[model samples]
Target chain A: DVKVTQSSRYLVKRTGEKVFLECVQDMDHENMFWYRQDPGLGLRLIYFSYDVKMKEKGDIPEGYSVSREKKERFSLILESASTNQTSMYLCASSSSGAGWGEQYFGPGTRLTVT
Target chain B: ELKVEQNPLFLSMQEGKNYTIYCNYSTTSDRLYWYRQDPGKSLESLFVLLSNGAVKQEGRLMASLDTKARLSTLHITAAVHDLSATYFCAGLMEYGNKLVFGAGTILRVKS
Candidate 1:
């Protein structure tokens, strides 16, 4: 079984503060993704890393960035937290092997930016 | 731009009832996935449909994909209260393996 772990399950930050959400996967998957889920909006990708030090912007990357210094860990950074940034964040990892490669997700972190 | 759409955003069904949720994509995709998410929780992968006419079943839930039509369906048979959750269908775009997820269907099963 694959396991993805998030650094925090719940977090609260004041406006204008910086926040970090961490995700680590035991499967050593090559692809890691960060997504924010909102009601009626589904899961929108914020950033993704295909390899160490390589990152790509997804649909909703504004005000957010990502880091992939190692194969097993991916980090999401909120430059300046705001009330609107409060939401559930999810991290997923997938392999580069055969087929499209099913994604394994972490438990998720619900961030509250006040 | 690849787009995924799910029909009937909300559904309330009685226990032991059956229903189907539809997912449609705007373009070609390499694969499709069905995932279940509980409130304030992460996603649990339910099924992965890889080809046209592909079908996969687990428990009382079955997923089918029609690549030619860019459509997927998740059918629930004799659903139970414990099965209540938000179901999302995601399509892997051909180019970069980026997943595009539908808005999701919220299922409420009652006794």
Candidate 2:
């Protein structure tokens, strides 16, 4: 069974606070991505990591950053949380091999900024 | 940049009815994916179409891809209440391992 776990299912943060959302996968996947799901915009990629300590900015990475220190762990950081950043955060892991594989998503973290 | 769009963002139908959700992409895409997301839950991959004129079916849901048209369709047969959920279609980006997703279609199956 494929499993992707996140640190929190629901989180509340104050403005100007630094927030961290952690994700871990047991599938030995080489690619991990973070996406924010909004009502009308669908899921927008924030950041992704392909290898340890390697990161790339996605379509909407303005207020987000990510860290991949270990093979199975990926972390998303909000330098300063804002109300506009309130959205459902999802973590996904996939294989980067020859053929593209379907990404396995985590349960997601619903963050509310106040 | 690639863009994916879906139509009839909200659909309501009675049980046993049939419907289709369409996905169109702006640029060329070789791989397409369909996902189902229930309320307050994560996404579940339903189908992956990798080639032109490819068709795959699982239970009551069937998906097809047309590379020449840059389009994909998810057809639902005999809708059930348990099939009520949001469906999303995504196109694989040209250069990377990223996907451009459509805005999703919310289907409500009523008894």
**Model 1 stretches astray by more than 4 angstroms:** none
TM-score, predicted candidate 1 vs. hidden true structure = 0.97
- Docking class for model 2 is medium
* DockQ for each model: 0.79, 0.77
Which stretch of 10 consecutive residues in model 1 chain A shows the poorest summed lDDT? A95-104
Candidate 2 ranges with C-alpha deviation above 4 Å: A98-101
* Best TM-score among the predictions, by candidate number: 1
lDDT of 1 by residue, A6-108 (tens): 9999999999998999999998799999999988788999999899999999999999999999999999999999999999999999998854468889999
Cα distance off (Å), candidate 2, residue B82: 0.9
RMSD to truth, every model: 1.0, 1.1
Q: Chain B, TM-score, each prediction?
A: 0.98, 0.98
Question: C-alpha displacement of A104 in model 1, angstroms?
Answer: 1.0
Q: Model 2, retained fraction of real contacts? A: 0.68
Tens-digit per-residue lDDT, A14-112, candidate 2: 999999999999988899999999998899999998888999999899988889999999999999999999999999998888556578899999999
B92: Cα error in model 1, Å: 0.3
For each candidate, report what fraction of the true interface contacts it reproduces.
0.74, 0.68
